[model samples]
Target: MPKMKTKSSAKKRFKVSATGKVIGSQAGKQHGMIKRSNKFLRNARGTTALSAPDAKIIKGFMPYDR
Candidate 1:
């Protein structure tokens, strides 16, 4: 059988947590850093678990991750 390809974008952007949840980095940190407040930058610094509905879809793209 042909290999099932994972979504390249999802592979790069999301992580599968120990609890089997999908996590992703907060957006808005990619640009305009100077205008962003310290609190906003700090809060956006880490990965966050995606909501259940979103995580379900992401898991479909990352078949091997599970």
Candidate 2:
């Protein structure tokens, strides 16, 4: 059988955690930081685990990741 291909965009944007959760960078930090509050900026740092529904979809894209 032919190998199933991973989605290129998904590979770049998301990662699977050791416990099988989807890990991704926090959103809304790419631009216009001057208008964003300090608390928002502080909280947005680093990666976050995606919700169950969202992680299920991401897992579909990365079949071999788990």
CA lDDT, every model vs. true structure: 0.93, 0.96
Residue-wise C-alpha lDDT for candidate 1, range 1-66, written one tens digit per residue: 888999999999998988898999998988899999999999898888899999999999999899
Q: Pick the candidate with the highest TM-score.
A: 2
* Regions of model 1 farther than 4 Å from truth: none
User: Lowest summed-lDDT stretch of 10 residues in model 1?
Assistant: 42-51
lDDT of 2 by residue, 5-66 (tens): 99999999999988998999999999999999999999999999999999999999999999
lDDT (Cα, 0-100) at 34 in candidate 2: 100
- Ten-residue region with minimum lDDT total, candidate 2: 14-23
CA lDDT, candidate 1, residue 42 = 91
Off by over 4 Å in 2: none
In model 2, residue pairs whose N, Cα or C atoms come closer than 3 Å (at least 3 residues apart or on different chains), thus clashing, are none
Question: For all the candidates, what are their Cα RMSDs to the real structure?
Answer: 1.5, 0.8
